[model samples]
Target chain A: MLKKETYINGFSSINPIKDSGNEEDVFRCVEPDYKTYIDTIAVRRLGKIQRMALVGAKMCLENAGVNLPDAIITGTGLGCLSDTEKFLGNMLDDESGLHSPTSFIQSTHNTISGQIAIMLKCYGYNNTYSHRGLSFERALEDASLLLLENTENVMIGAVDEIPDSTLKITQKVKTFYSKSHRNEPVAGEGVHYFLLSNAKQPNSILLKEFSSIEGKVSYEEILLECKRILLSAGIETREVDALILGTNPNIDELHYQQLQNELFLNSNVLQFKNLTGESFTASGFGVVLACKFLLGQTLDERMYLKKKHSKAQTVLIYNQFKGISHSFFLLQNV
Target chain B: MPSKVYVTGLGIISAMGVGVSETLRSFSTEKTFVRHPEILKTLLKEQYPLGEVRFSNEELKSLLKINSKQSFSRTSLLALIAAKEALFSSRQKESPLGIGVISGTSVGGMDKGEYLYDGYIRKNGKFNLHDAFVHDCGDSTNKIVSYLGTQAYSTTISTACSSAANAIMLGARLIKAGKLQRVIAGGTDALTRFTLSGFRSLMILSDEYCKPFDQNRKGLNLGEGAGYIVLESEEILNKENRKPICELTGYANTCDAFHQTASSPDGNGAWLAISQALALAGLNAEEISYVNTHGTATPNNDLSESMAMKRVFGEKMPPFSSTKSFTGHTLGAAGGIEAVFSALSIRDKIIFPNLHFQDKMEETGIQPTTDFKKEVEIKHVLSNSFGFGGNNSSLVFSAC
Candidate 1:
């Protein structure tokens, strides 16, 4: 838990489903013009993930009215995937040693945050977390720590991109969704950036608390842990006006459906993976939506799993990656 | 008072040798292990010298008593071995239920992933499905947690060379914040064609023995291994009545924000990290007994770090040396390996030598401690780990 209260001042994201209107299961981010945010010449040299992260981070900082943050923290599962592949593929072909150093230089996990800092000329605390599903949560936790350490404002983000080669290789090795689900949850990639501060603002969304667990935790144990977390925050599970789960039309929802039916029966149940698809850092989009719903934004019709008609002042975002890693975030409007 | 973070145990595996005793002996005997590669099957094996661990994957696995049938990346194997040593040195009676594992690595399992992917791409060799799963940077940390058989919370940090330093920093912060009572924090990397070729392409792969802080230093020799330390809070130490090796008194991380690959001419980030870390420890500049430098032996790094040292301790400078002179610049694991060395320096009261140094740099006219010394009244040691992306971190290990 944070020693000081942390508030989400601004948030922005670039995911696949915003304006595609393709009606197909295939997904890719609706990328914006990189030149608008990044330098024109630099955009040509930037990788896809770097462009997406910079645009999202710039928009988020603008929304928060901060030109430079005290710290920059980022998280990613497969960082600079395209560049990594390029460097590796070239080596495989030539075998005469590495050719160009450009791709190799950009392939590090911290490249994104380092580039952002270079662009802003913000020589502050910079860190990157590359844990699998918990990457974004780790970044969030570090941001809260920085805020408690008296950093006025911190810029934190979660960004992951799936190149075609990565997608093909991963699909052959991993299974994200079950076959019985009506809508197959396809692989996804996106960038979500948030500006967090210890000082409250006029329209700040209070980040109450968050907790995560790893390994083989039973569904019942997960629910109990959530209950304990909420209790620690002086709130009851029943008082949670809305529950935003990482559930999609794929997989069993692994007791998430049971959670909705048994516990939050009268509360609005929401789903975001159907829109953003599945990725390690996809839970970040849940955080963005949680903030929006807390700020009086209504849920899209497609996102509703259970439509309980009421204003949502408190939202709990729960996410699990294949029953391996689980995380919960509690947010409040006040 | 805030809780103090203590180093209860230390484990390291570098080219210097395996475990603490071999490493200390290598330092005392003044022997350099940078030699031609015999294990890593890279195309440039004869071109550049490397400080590789003197064990193959099968050898390491067997040494660690791992099942022969299982497939483990060299990175994970090294990490597991070092972490096990650290856990044992900590003298824990039983499995630490609430222990946390935070690891750092630039290339997680690329040692196996490269060959597996290469075989897959060429379609001439078999593709093991299990081998494909270890591609992510988090795989090594996961391996450590599972191998320890503890229901621990773990994460991986990848800030290139400074990764393990950041891991230790985060672990200390978490302990100080009362989030966890104990943590095993460090980093591991295995020699692979990807990184070897990457550095070769960058033209920073030294063909000869790395001479850090030398006038005509060319580049660094790549090394591979793992280093980890058991960090515990004051509360846990008191309850367990354990003797601590040293205390992690201060740590700081700062970015140069100068260039993606090249460091600034002035080493602004390095200076900030060192000064802030010293400030956090509430110690004067003169209190630092020995400084473990981030000298990669590159002309740029030596010059910049020299300037930073000049700014911090002008005239009356303390004895400082780059242990990379022996370890061969372990990239992501450099911070961790150097940290274990720093702890050893405090525990044994010695300063390791900087080998293969001839002439001092013309710019700052600074030279390193060329002779190993023992029985010194060393109270504080500062270790610097700077990496690509301008990430610079410094940690202060103090004697109790």
Candidate 2:
């Protein structure tokens, strides 16, 4: 079967960190201007999750110069955490009285996707995926499938928000950062959007191929799969200049180290999670970082794993959400 | 340029019944299942009606033979039950045909999440971290996959009410793309106070039976159920000499981008989706034998869908009906449930009645088939599912 080529024509993100377009600049911590983007009255009703998604989606479309996309596909690990917490809290607090419907309505997993479609007046294919870590990757896969089927101009993204109630709950369950580790790192909200097109554009990075895997595949096995992808793109592993690894200091260091040893034995290894705290769809932020790295931008100190490296020619992005949904993508500079 | 996708098996558990046979029997008998919420414990149980599956969580867990002390959300248990029945009906259990599972769900384990949230936050309350696992919508799909004992490919789609329809669309595309030979595609959603209150807040919940396309139609009654269908590629069907129930001829998904929770007044998105599906199927609107309208009975939905149908069919619209009167609005599961109903319509040569229609809407002259009809040769059936955020999908199923 003849394969249709797809390219990432544009990208944007708005997180706890700075917004997109300032690649060389990095902020250690972000104090977002929520009031500027959201109305005070609306802000009262808006949960942190909805606000983050709305702002990020707006920024993505503005960056992509797309008034409306053919489809809107989004992924989230925890959907509307703040609203979920609020609704559940209210339900348990008073079982009978009329509860505020805003939180409950927003708590559905597809709210973000629905909001994006509504905001854009994009009555196209709108879908959301919530698969723990693989959420964003699954959305990407669906976007790619649409492209392959001759659908054009899709907006695909991942958004995750940090809710105080959820944070407290996770802490109580010991699934979140402990008091001892709170100062070490803080969870942040982020939204990364990509304008994918079948037609390659100038200054665009060709999304050669993407593959999702589950379970623990040996390093050799992963390398084999990587080779097949690279081979299909008519490139050699030796020809690749840099490898961008989604290494979270908390959970992914060891796996990143072992995988790097096997795949990038000779190539330069670059890591970026230290600059951006771990989130379900943080791999998407990593993809943006890889794109910048491939565009000949200098790496920030917080994102570098090694010293200065040669200009990146071809870059490989390998991300796993929670050691389960492993994904690989090979990209080449135009 | 088009691909062939076959629906070999169908399974569903709704307020109407537990299996395909039961559901069909109810449909044929013109039995309406909308009633006051019984299985779910809620304050508005007596005030609002719901299309509930009439089984408590404990009863469902026992029936599924699951002994895990950890609670299974109403959604997961319903999904597992429906998916298992689908796999059993297909009889391709041990066959290595690269089977995949794609489910559409909106709330997922919110039922469990709602129960565990307070416990997790309050130190005095016992909290199981495992319960948080249900917070992810994909967890339910993952659980279904594990229960099936096959993992060629698995994913979940959540686009509000259109989720399952989109799941079915993706499953068909995967087979057409030769990514997998067979896939179990559907959606499951259970009634929760969260959704009920949410709809109530929207002022769209009906106290009596939902009357779609009626001038007096108040709003939709929320429903809880699961639906699944086994889709196989033509190559696999030919190799195994399997019988196909219906052919998933074409599908199209388009967003309305009209409002956060309401469809466009003109139904532009719905028109595009229907036109695209018809174009892909290489058929005209006149060729459709019947249409399963995404009639949620809401003042907005019925009007919008009716306008779109008139735009596509012009003066010659096919026989159409909204079965939501039977099962209510199943949310994410509505697409899957209605898809099964479409296949049944094709196989059984029947048109399920759209109950509780009193008067036609002033805006659109379209009235649904209000009584069950038999011996009708249904060659091609169009199923529409539009959801919150303007997500609109239309699927075309043809008799095998």
Scored by DockQ, the top model is: 1
lDDT (10s digit) by residue, model 2, range B91-207:
784553368999999889877777677666744578667777776688789888777777688888887899899999989988899888899999999998778877887789899
RMSD of each: 1.8, 3.4
Candidate No. with top TM-score = 1
Regions of model 2 farther than 4 Å from truth: A18-48, A90-95, A180-186, A216-220, A251-253, B69-71, B93-97, B122-124
Residues A166-249, model 2: lDDT tens digits: 666555554445564442224545778888888776767878777778666676666677777888888877676777887765
lDDT of each: 0.87, 0.80
DockQ of 1: 0.76
Docking class of 2: medium
TM-score of structure candidate 2: 0.93
- Residue-by-residue lDDT tens digits, candidate 1, B1-400: 7799999988999888889988888887786788889999977888888999999988888888888566789899989888888888999755777789999999888888787777775564677877777888899999999888766668899999999999999999988888888999999998888998888888887899999999989999999999999999998889979899999999999999999888899989999999999999998999999999998998888888989999999896899999988889888888999999899999999998999999998889998999998999889999999989899999999999
Q: For each candidate, report what fraction of the true interface contacts it reproduces.
A: 0.73, 0.69
lDDT of 1 at B201: 85
lDDT of 1: 0.87
Give me the runs in candidate 1 sitting further than 4 Å from their true place.
A20-26, A176-184, B122-125
